[model samples]
Target: MQVIRNGFLSLLALGALTLEGHAQAVVAALECDFPAASTDDWNMAASTLQYYIDTARGWRVDEDSFSFDGTANIVVDGKDHVASLSITVSRQSGRANKTLRSEGRSLTVSGECRKMEASGRKF
Candidate 1:
């Protein structure tokens, strides 16, 4: 009976992992700098933003993001006439590019990403 119980528990754990996308995910933060875009610039003063990425779906930038398929890469597009911010990051290489526009001025920043502990290099 004990052996049977152990087998059942193992099966349950395996099922849970399977349902959760093989337990794959990536957690990281993006840090960037922006020069003065005039005083009327957007208030995105945060130097770093945390990301919670779903390898099969998409990632959230500090809990907000434009939805897109992020299996191979991360792509986001947030725009309007007054302001726009777009991001593209390769999941395999961890290279990132971001563009910010406000009040008719725009800036693009590119850099490598640092994955958090246990986050691994690939999503």
Candidate 2:
């Protein structure tokens, strides 16, 4: 009788732990930052970022664009515009698909156009 009771309690404990884990997985957020100079540059960066996000099998983007109120900081330096944009990307396993939140700055040079590098991790 004691053996049966112990087994039942162990099963109950295991079930509770499983439930807790599931709950935790259901409600969690991941955050990161991608730095850029201005809106046009950010637009280019966002395109590449979108490409990766779209290609990933299990990942989904939560928001589509960056709100100036939430994720953008702009500064003008002589002939250059410096911008920092914050973006959030999220994915759900089963029902809800995915989303991407993007924000950044654009650079426009008056004279000759030059090649520039955009840097950041997609995931």
TM-score of each: 0.39, 0.19
lDDT digits (tens) for residues 23-58 of candidate 2: 311222222222222343332221111112221222
At residue 117, candidate 1 shows an lDDT of 45
TM-score of 2: 0.19
Model 1 per-residue lDDT tens digits across residues 1-123: 011101111211111145656773333433222222223343333244334344332444332332222222211244424335565666555566656554566555554554544543343
lDDT score for candidate 1 against the true structure: 0.38
Indicate the residue-level lDDT of 27 in model 2. 20
Cα RMSD to native, each candidate?
A: 15.4, 19.9
Question: Total clashing residue pairs per candidate?
Answer: 0, 13
Which 10-residue span in candidate 2 carries the lowest summed lDDT? 1-10
The best candidate by TM-score is 1
